[model samples]
Target: MLVYSDDYLEVIHRPASSSCILVTFNEMEMQANGSRFWGQRFCEKADFAALGFISRRPNWFPAASIEKAAAATAAILRQASERILYGHSQGGYAALRYRLLLNADVAIAFCPQLSIDPAAVPFDGRFTRHFAPALHADMEIMPEHAAGRAYVFYDPFHAVDRMHAEWIAEKQRETRLLPVHMTGHGTVRAFAGTARGLALIESCRADDVPGLRALARSVRTGAAMRPYQVALTAIARHPAWADRLSARFGNGFSSVERVNFLYHRANRHIRDGELATARDLLVEAMALQPNNLGPARRLQELDARIVRTSRT
Candidate 1:
């Protein structure tokens, strides 16, 4: 399911997991203004049981309003056994607020707006507006139970994120801090390009668990200069992901170079017995360059092979 406001909260269920993983998402545009537009799009990311509150805060949700929303979310998430909170931009701000209020086992925040209290607010815990998440109290974050982990991802080139990064580093917890000096905040691909989250997710698997511990050690150092390439590589390496992405985005965002890269990757998946994934990439190629018949024909060939194999 997808929770939508200005951004989308999607729960991705991988076959490797017996349960679903909820993703609380906030759109950069929506969170920029802090409005929660309700719809089915605002539904659960994964199973409501496995994943709970995905607060999508607008850019202007003050600091405390975001906290209140998150407090409500915490009540929802506690019902679930395993849960995580993730957000981008202002949404990240909300996720952090929620973590401060209810506390999640894990939170992935990207370019989160760390709020500073106005000097005139009487200094007695009454914020000028909403409840501030990162107050002086945040200086010593009292973890609820598990002593949760936070991985704050940001871009170094984006001076705004950099400034906030500097501020947050002061109140250090078990932090997975990443600075993408190359890519700015806007273009940072949370879905496909985030290495820290991927490493964490990969570690969950029993087989990759061994090497992942080492990878997890260098989590902050994994930011890529070419995030597009990183995303494509991730999709290519994972079965059916490229196809799923192609189906959703078409070739609108992908370039000619990306098309070619996907084609090669798609073919690799075909050779590796991932026909479903290969067919999806072929479809993406065909969509990107309709006049080029090679991909279309290749798709047909693959379909025919699938049919023949099924019959045999």
Candidate 2:
């Protein structure tokens, strides 16, 4: 049921008689299409009602500005017996922020932005599009003043996400930081693709921290997690590693993942000043995933550089 809808956000409630409720938030810069959104689909079969929040923008609710929507959401959550929150990226921030307000039991945030305010995260510019709104909003502190425990999932090697997680842990004593290395900022998708996402969610729902930790470690070591392997190759920037990973893993990556693999390998070649190799890799990337614009744009840039160098 659509509980509240406004220009800024939409809150939908899927009521079940179960004792638990899962409150979800949408990622930054993503359009939430009714119940078909990512978080909704992910927790669909769980034995809990779902309260999904679809943000039209990346303002992080701007609590002072959207009092009506916030109040409505609070009312809905306050009625629930046991509430657990789930989200990825910007939605992760919401899952943490409102956990205390709603008195939720647990929060599972994947690669969450603790704060986008320049004052809080002065070095992070990943969300420059929402800077003005974030500045005006209550982006002063990490949402650590909550009652229930929060589990934060992020890649330790990912600079921005690591920084956010570290800061959140530093500020919030009850937070458990899980490092899912090589998954980059898309840990949710990486785990989902591996079919262990539901199990992890269930662990969180049960408040089984040990089980969750074991599952997360399996995500790092599991050979069936093709996307994680592909991401590792991309981060490693080695063509041979990509080839070996592809050979061992077979064609397990999505179309976009394939493009990323090629593009990153191409980028490595470019850095090495192997223009022809980089161009060839980008061409293959475009051929494999023709609709992906990253390789196309990189290809154009490579061609322009080649032309300029030839003229000189």
Best by TM-score: 2
The lDDT of model 1 is: 0.50
For model 1 the TM-score comes to 0.43
lDDT of 2 by residue, 109-196 (tens): 9998877777678878878568675335666435455668889998887788999888887876578888887677777665764247
Candidate 1 global Cα RMSD: 16.9
User: In candidate 1, where is summed lDDT lowest over 10 consecutive residues?
Assistant: 8-17
Model 1, range 1-312, lDDT digits (tens) per residue?
A: 222222323222212232333436464454222223221132323212233233343332333443444444444445545556666665565555556454556666677655534442222222235444443334222233122566666766556666665555555465556654434564235234344445554443223434543553344244332444334544546635655654554444445645665677778878888899889989988887887777878899999989988999
lDDT of 2 at 5: 76
The 10-residue segment with the lowest total lDDT in model 2: 223-232
Give the clash count for model 1: 11
Candidate 2 accuracy as TM-score: 0.81
